[model samples]
Target: MRKRRTAYLSGLLALTVLSGCGSSGHSSKPSASPTAAVSWKFTTLDLGIPDKVLKAPVTGKVPDDKTLHVGVTLKVSDEAWKKFGHGKSPAQRAGDVGKDLGITDAQLQKVQAYLNQAHIQAKTSKTRTSVTFDVKAGQAAKLLRTSFVTHKLNGRTYFTPDPNHPPQIPEQIKPYILAVTGLESYSVAPKARALGASAPGRALPTRAGRCIQRFPQKFASSQRVAAAYGFNQLWGQGWRGENMTVNLVEMDGYDRNDVANYVACTGAHIQLGNVNLGATEPAVGAEATLDIQMLAGLAPNLRIVDYQEDPELLNSGNGADSWAALNNALQRIIDDNADKKRPGSIVSISMGGPEGFLSQPIMQAIDQSLRILTATEQMSVFISSGDCGAFADRQYGSLDVSFPASSPYAVSVGGTRLDLAPNGARTGEVVWSDRSSLSRCENQWGSGGGVSKVFQRPSYQQAPGADNRYAASGGRQVPDISAAAINLPIYFRGNWVSSGGTSAAAPIWAAGMALVNQGLLARAHIFCYGPDTFYHALSAGAANRPYTDVVAGNNLYYPATAGFDLSTGLGSPNLPAFFNTLAANPG
Candidate 1:
């Protein structure tokens, strides 16, 4: 969601008008309901596209030969999801998690048999709670009783099932099915939330002090920004993120040379690792390097793992392949920690798409996974709110936030511009909205924050001062926290280039969380604090002072306020204060 955007308001308006006319040249009417001979009665499974997406202009028919990856999420009742979290440890809880969940072995076998009869290659996850498989687009459309077509919206292409016709499943299996994913794919994949003028054809600013000339903003060194946010306070107290591990969920690959250069420049000792879940290592990019180097500069002595997603799955031809890939990586993280009996690790994700850009089923599946990670698995997950301010879908002045950042389970990190004195003390900070000649909006390239259409406000938001004025009735507001995002320098490729986005903000919080976890583990022998704990602690007395309230500026549509607001949520953190507060009330 951090990739530079082109104005698409006019095209989107036209597409919205044209799509309501009728089908876009492909007829995929099923011969019969459920479309196959089965022992049980069937019912329609409504995985309807969001109104914003369903109205997009159809560009063409999906190619029949393109292979589609599909994931079927089996139902685990709310009671079971809550009951499974009662164990003493995450591993102990997971030991019976699959068994306690509703999906029986016989039920899984029945589903597998159905797929085998159709000759589709499929396999269930280790938990036996979900099944994943690959099938041709034509055959999938036939089996799902729908049509596959390509649509163009906001200068990006997406392949999806027909909104007019919903998919059908057996009534017997319907009770066990939560949702399905990978039926919709982005041709232009979601991007990492890092900004820079180093991209090809972008002209650097003529100003000598500006770091990334394309944006022409004055850059702040990573060390200076860290100091302003209280990293020095934590370090002085002997908490340099030791014995902490953070997994960075990334869509692109990074370069080791750049990581090395950044570490050398920052003089931080850290361990680095990578887990490629079928993704190809493309040429080095700014986003991945920026994420790693930012952590390196701040955490000093932490373990970082880059979980890379597949490139093929990110293309237009692969329907929702990127989404499937993300799910797989998430499940792997849970399984790895559980199988090894390791403590819950922090997860940092800097990539996301607007909630409306994705279908309902896709968001539900991802949110379900996040719920397990934060609620059941006890891991702290932080994600970038986005780089498009309130206009995530590129609708100009319209408002929208990104997901899974908007998922109630995630800590949505927003962006801010920090002004530091010569002594590296904080002078002023505001919502990050920078507009130069190359910008598209009056408030271009600001932090992404707004109300979520898909998710309801979570229990934690019920805390005093967490509610926002712009949130719709029962809607979720973002972001949960803010950080210095603008003018942050990172060693990319061969040089120390700088840019700003919620991308930097996410890792900054992740690094801070790692240190906080180390302190908690040392004192209370606890793995990691849950989202609810942080919410309750920060919401309590003013004596704690865990965060510095950001009460200035706006993300186009939402303005910052005295307490919680859509722009900066609880504002930027005071790390030592935050850790001390958590130590006092270690939930």
Candidate 2:
């Protein structure tokens, strides 16, 4: 999977490109029989779009000629899901496994034919259980029997298939199809879980003196980061994330010059690459910069790939075209890896919104897609839990968790406020929360963590340390782990900034996972890709100093406790010790 050595870019770029991105899924049993094949009529699956969204003011109909890209989630048989036990899949490549678990060849052919009859183009995804296509609005509306209408809600404008009218498919194909998404033409805007000054490509002073003088004790230097997280131990042991790649999911692009400058500034050795799924923003955003810079700083020798998505799909002025970009980007990662084009088993996604905000079909499609990565591809995915603590949606008196983060297969990362001595020894750490500084309804920023309103607790999460108070909720607990999220150093745009939040915390876990995989590959001849390895390691007791449990803080609502709690989950990593445990067991 090695590429020709190119000129060193930013340390973050080089390291990030080498460190791959993450994946997800957990069997949510499908009702469709594996052997059933019958001719039928037409129906619609409840998409679960909120009534508030449905009631929004309709601006107008989407242009008939506008192209809309949609994702179709097919049913997976119970027998296929049974094959994937609690830990891993028997299939070596995720793409090949889909035929058994996802859509059969006959099913794909029938669905494609049906869509073709409507002048719509569609094809099955290599990663399985999904079909994607782009079709003109008029054709899509005619086929689904719904008009696409623009709506303005809460100061934001977007569009969807007429909420009053459900999208329908032929009865013969309904059994094979779970849900068809992208008809909404917009995603609940993803919040980048970070806090800092952001200037995409603006020029600013490169000197560290300015930032250091301004932030004082707030920012941690690269050296401090290494010392704080026990990365020094891994580096001394020759495990600096070499022979590893990390994939970063982003909505924007970064400046190579900025990467190069950061690399030079931090003396980080990193290489970077990009794969654009659709039309992306011209300049970089702080979220993308933070992810790259943090990965570059921690795993300097790792390779990073930034998977950017379409900007127009998310922009305010227009929003009725391509809402499936995130799913497209994720599926692309699985396809690329399965094909050995860019084989990265590690992934990090720092963007997400409340789980409740996404339609049920969209949420299911995303979770099921993630299942392919974690169960089939055996990849590790780290997602920022969110930056708004228990109030994930940021609406007062509401408790929630971020989607994808709440997905069972993903390793949800929360945030912590850490105190380190001059020598980089941890003095103390607490759950990150700005409860006192801001209003409860608007600015109560902190690490996102809570009981999921969706997704049952995966088997791995049923371990002894888990919090069962929310057991009746039947949802997975968020933030399986956490890391310091405050005052982490990042070189963004053209200046050094003190960045923090779960956005900054997620990459730390991703970089650390890269090192863990590197070490495991050397000894076990395999990489620990799924959450099984992490849960196993944490369950190992004192044998592995898995995490430094945070028992002293809260994310506004949930308080950190002795073991696993809603806030901060399993606490911050114990680092090299955790790595050593995984290397020895390689579960």
Candidate 3:
């Protein structure tokens, strides 16, 4: 009997505080019970300020100077922004990314002067990319080059700018202000959970195989991922992400006890890199723990930077009230590695909400940020597509995808279920689309994917067959790639657990990318690789090997195909072959 997170999330998200908090491995509530996933947080947690409070600022029409609040991002200069586009390695990259990009003293003074003129008080970040200021509706209306108005979405009222025109700044400050964010008053939270599900029974094994790592007798561990994906061969090469760094963007806090326990169990050679993106939460569950442990198990020596942000900011758009928290975290990473073209290799974001909830301007803003990281800084963000599958919001019942994943700049990771024989040999893999027809289960969760309504088809995706036969017209495709995502065992918080979702697929890809970066850096002095190189390599492989074609299963809306399909794009990674190819000719 396994516990699932969906059940608890369905009941307003209760949580149990860890006893002796910092001691690590001290959970006040024992999870040894079979139904540990049940909401046993000791007390019911109020979700805080209701959605109606978000609509409080919306006053009839024109807003007062005191009531009108706006969020701003003082971005880099044009030249500094352009530097990230080149394919040079971090060492070869010129200039310190943050300092050069930060608002010059002269520019800051001018902004401060302008704020005084507008009677606005704003806070600036150390990096100067994220700014939070309050201004009269009149001032904000002029700066954004647009006016604010009340809008109705899903029977809810929120404040937003007109859709006809994009935001703009006066010519004098245009050079310094990369973008104007935080226009929306309210934010929408993403409904996703790090839940686990299992099929009825295991399939028959072919050739004898062994589990990846031994676990306690009480819990079951399968090495099908090891035997099937060829992680064994990569591990054998000692390419254990020794020098690479994987920055993970997590929505919730993590349990250090889980990290210590995972390390003790798997002998992972690493510690924690904690970067607080927002105020700390009271208690955390398996999400962060699984992300860290999985990456450590796959690439034990890889340096990890956990960018912990306020989960409230998640699913919030650039203009939304809590938007700056997320933007601040991403920009910090870009600036920290600004010393080089690609200071970091991969960043995994296992959290995202339905794309429909995000405003067009907000989504566009996030897309630009991600593009800067990948196209310019040489980083690939592996984002979990979402666990809600095609119908991100079951209440709406529309085939919508998730944000960040839908962003063309990210490598959206979908899910799959691998069937292994008793011998540990993999028989085949199918989309991890488990909509239980049996009694007692009503969850319609799997992989989130579909043609994006916000983003257009990027040049990298314009290639023939990039869009499947059923591909939606006039939009970008999701899940550029996929991995084994279902019913995998993860060691966390001093206990063994089984879970699956695109959350599992994301880190696996991040680890693989780390391996690729390690290999590329080993052979060349400075390396510049992007989706173009990665996509071209997919077609360049001998008979297009290295990636197993997942022609079975569907995500309720999109089906898997031979080449690239919405379900599992380009299929799962085939190890050394992928890394070798990406390294040898990273054109």
Q: Which has the greatest lDDT?
A: 2
Candidate 3 ranges beyond 4 A from true positions: 1-70, 73-82, 98-110, 118-130, 133-179, 191-193, 197-223, 312-319, 340-344, 395-397, 437-444, 462-464, 470-472, 492-494, 526-528
Query: What tens digits encode model 1's per-residue C-alpha lDDT throughout 112-189?
Result: 655655577565555555577778988887767788887887776777777777666667677787788877765224
* Residue-wise C-alpha lDDT for candidate 2, range 214-321, written one tens digit per residue: 234545666676777787777787877676888888877677766777777666787787786655334677777888888887887887878887655556433223
Model 1: lDDT of residue 284:
65
- The models' CA-based lDDT, in order, is 0.69, 0.71, 0.61
Candidate 3 lDDT for residue 79:
68
Greater TM-score among 1 and 2 belongs to 2
Order of candidate numbers by TM-score, starting with the best = 2, 1, 3
lDDT per residue, candidate 3, 1-587, as tens digits?
00000000001011112221111111122123223222212211111223444344444444645255344555656666665454444544445444555677667655555554445556665445555555676677664566666655455666655443334444455555544555664456544346552223322222212223543322223244655777667767766777677887766767776666556555567645777756556246567766876787677677787777666555344236444555556766765665543343678877676676655445554665676667545677788887766766543257887887888778888888777665556778888786664222223467677888777777777433575565558788877778877666764443456766788889987887776666556565434344555576675566436677788988877777777888887778787777666555555
Model 1 weakest 10-residue run by lDDT:
10-19
Please state the error at residue 403 of candidate 1 in Å: 0.9
Q: After superposition, how far is residue 26 of candidate 1 from its true place, in Å?
A: 36
The top-ranked prediction according to TM-score is: 2
Greater lDDT among 1 and 2 belongs to 2
Which is the winner by TM-score between candidate 1 and candidate 3?
Answer: 1
Clashing pairs in 1: 184-320, 185-320, 205-213
